[model samples]
Target: MKKRVWRSGLMANQGFNFQKEHPGIALCGLDCYACPRYHTIGSSRCPGCAGKYFSEKHPSCGFISCAFKHGRLESCGLCPEIDTCNRITRLKTVIKDQPGYPSYQNRIANLIKIKGTGFEAFADTCIHKEALLKTLIDKYNDGRKKAFYCRAVQLLPLPDLENLLDENAKKGYKSVDDAALAVSNSLKELANKLGIEVC
Candidate 1:
């Protein structure tokens, strides 16, 4: 049998339609756009789980193959076997030790949020949040703060994030480094209040 190759896009133009097509949601409910890898520019960029680039890279990934091809589900949350799926359980175990990756608990929470809000609404929210996160990164990120900022954005509510952005904007810092320092300090405090560590 010939190999079944799923090619979505090629290099350079890959993931161009990522926002419109996938809105960053993975089959397993991870927000691909919010991930650090997805934000990276150039050849190392990830097109997200719904992007063609992801299919090209992880064509046979268990979540993609099982949910889309076999289970015929959009997200694992829609599957009756989601709770009992060995794959999910195994993945959860694997990600636990991986720093900077979303914990299994975070994935489950995102799934529940998506199930409650519907795909379009969830995608819209993700897009909006991603924009806010990008602003935070662009304005406030030092070279070492990307992961910390991403984690802070993921943990905080949209309104809070927006408020922080607005507040930070009004501070009139002297330099990009100054803005980054202040934002980083404020985000660290906010993260502490939310019971999340931004390190």
Candidate 2:
């Protein structure tokens, strides 16, 4: 039996559609685009799960390798066997109650959204959140607030998140430190009002 190649290599050899289908979402439904590492520059930057250079960055990501085994599927959520999959069970156990980066908590929600709205729509939603997250990173990252910022954008509604970002932009700041603190506080207040706990 011939070995089956997947992702970028397969895209080059076979015009694989999975790589292009919804680029930033992982097979297990993590929002790669919202991750701080995805926003980092230089060699440390992650290209998102199953994203370009992903094979180089995370060649052993179990879910991606699993998708390769499962007929080149784009997302595990699309798999018929998702409900019974031990991998997802493991994932839920692993991501539970981590102190920071609550964005990872969105994994199951992202999968459910993918199941409900399809990949294209889910991609659009991720893209919108990515743009918002980039703005937060570019303007308000105090070198310590990236995780909170990521969680805020992931957990908050787009219009509300965007509104807070815009509101923060118009405020005067004595320094970037002040600006970063204000942005964190603003998002925190919004998070509190929504009962979402972005911290």
Candidate 3:
């Protein structure tokens, strides 16, 4: 049997499993499953945002939608007008909570501006997830004392607002408890292990 080279858009390492030990947590608003990066990595499951996609069956992402539709942003990072971007602005809160988020977002922003797609850099990061995880863990621990280590935040499948409403008896409410929180905890722990300062 010939090996299947996973190719959604770009090239990637065959047999790479993105969801190895990850717990369910929606790290970003984007659907990782539809992301060309995840597709190329052989992940049938969306890294995060599966629940939302499952509900619409179209994988409607607030970030992607806003970028392509509302903001007219080819890419979130490429948006010439960042002030008009609610999606990126919303993410700012989440990014601010984590030590490593600003840098990551800036890096992605830079990549999006310079490189057409952010997936190439993401794919490279995924290629070294383990090493990166370890490094981040160390940095987290080290940063704790000084309070400035950027820990890797875990991304998981995000349930759509409809799904959340449905599960919540259609009250149209969602909370941190609605989705899995362990993934974030794990990511935080990993950062701590790496000696990254985190609170």
Candidate 4:
């Protein structure tokens, strides 16, 4: 069997067209454009984080595992405790007043309200989403909150995790456990950069 490698921008639907268009060549901090799995079908739509995109592929997103998914809501904003999740807390820290901050917050809140649960629920729903979940948890515990809510953050934004792995992979780690510890620390460093709460 040949090994299958997937990037963030590979897509099957070449005929798909992007309904949501960004007029100006504005760079959203996210690198969805670089993803090999984005709608390569020519649709301007982003399937990675878009709920609609997920619905197309039945059993598509980690959101289904989210508490909110079963709750019959779209996002966290509808939750009575929308302000309480660590994810939301971290987002507020770095995105304050940024052009897209408010919109991001609203999106998460809406997802929770509509989906009715924490992103962890969705993340745990699939193995593919597991790495992203761990990254988010690590970021939250470390103090960096910028990765909150946005699926893109959950996916490729693992600077801290990567650093630790890069260091450990080269260093003579005493054991696999030691390497794990290093990765944990990297996540902490990332959190510190974002001022996320370590609780």
Candidate 5:
């Protein structure tokens, strides 16, 4: 498989690394590239699960310590015991119980996709997702809506997000605040129509 490594967009030193591991895709299947923490400007940012200084920038995670760090694999889905992994099963159970955290819900399916397509191909999709998120962070972010934009980009389909952005681009805004509000409303409307939980 071809390694579709990409340079970081808005976050060159922030995250989106391509050193030896894929910073976009996590071992547990979180889209780290689309995470709010990855886009944080003021606070100390999360450099992604596999990003540079990952062990230093972020807290010590059980998932990494237990499985990921011991091997060279980019994801737990590559493990032979993925189907019988107790930690992953429990993690999925926790995710299922958390209705407020919609992003976590995508992890299991993402892991399965990694298993089928391999890390490189699955990460190709993640790079595209990150690109969409990067566009929002770079243009639409009004210093406060980073998290909201991240959630919207993560939950919504790529085509839907692309179309929404294209539609919004044709409109005029008075200021950064106006631009933010306009996109916010549009994103909410899209979320409602799609029955997507973006909080």
Candidate 6:
């Protein structure tokens, strides 16, 4: 069988501009842009969970299939059963143990926020968060910290993240090393408070 490729306009180098298209938000509330796969180049690229591309790649994706069966809603948040769905609970349990996966709890939270605030507002929030995350990635990320940083951004409130970014900027750091050192403990503390793993 030919390999299936999900084609979302959001894939890097796939002619989709995330900042312009806002294609990073998935129906399950996964921030496709924040996933390392989304940033990957070449054949490993993913257009995100909401991408126009669908294939046998995820034959067991209950979220996708369920959404399709239920009026083709853009997100599970639209479903009245969202809070009580067994599939979502099962998926969350599976995702929680996966290292480097965006926080499942966070995904649900994003879904609720999206449902309450509307896609346009949610997309704007995502874009702003991405910008902040980019700043951290540019200034503090080493080869090993990418996943940790992504998780941190996902778990931290936007205001807290913005404050951290501002704090770093105010410190006049001279190098990535310096910036990382300055924020490492604080990041760890915040992660711990949220009961999230940073490593």
* Model 3 lDDT tens row, 77-174: 44555555565566667666665333343433433433454534444343344333333333323323211212232231122212322343423324
| Model 5 lDDT, full chain set | 0.76
- Report how far off residue 107 is in candidate 3 (Å): 10
**Residue 11 in model 3: lDDT:** 23
Better of 1 and 4 by lDDT: 1
Report the lDDT tens digits of candidate 6 across residue range 1-199.
2233343212322222112234477778778767766655566677666464434223335566566566656677778888799977876787677665554556777778877877788887777877877777777865556666777776677887888778778787777777777776678887788776765
Q: What tens digits encode model 1's per-residue C-alpha lDDT throughout 1-199?
A: 1332334223213333222256377777777767787788788888777565565555445565566544345566667686789977876786667665553347777776667767677777778888988997787877777777777777777887888889988888988888888998888888788887667
Q: State residue 119's C-alpha deviation in candidate 5, in Å.
A: 2.5
Please report the TM-score between candidate 5 and the true structure. 0.80
lDDT of each: 0.70, 0.76, 0.35, 0.39, 0.76, 0.67
* Each model's total of backbone clashes: 0, 0, 25, 44, 0, 1
Q: Rank the candidate models, highest lDDT first.
A: 2, 5, 1, 6, 4, 3
TM-scores of all candidate predictions against the true structure: 0.76, 0.79, 0.30, 0.27, 0.80, 0.67
Off by over 4 Å in 2: 1-21, 69-71, 92-100
TM-score of 3: 0.30
CA RMSD, predictions in order: 5.5, 4.1, 17.6, 17.1, 9.1, 7.3
Candidate 4 residue lDDT tens string, 1-199: 1233332222322212221122110011122322323423466544543334544644333322332332533333444554566655655574555554333333343344334554344333323333444443443323333234233333333554455545645667565455445555555566677765332
Predicted model with the maximum TM-score? 5
**What would the C-alpha RMSD of candidate 2 be, to one decimal place?**
4.1
Candidates 5 and 6, the one with greater TM-score: 5
Measured on C-alpha atoms, candidate 2 has an lDDT of 0.76
Q: What's model 2's TM-score?
A: 0.79
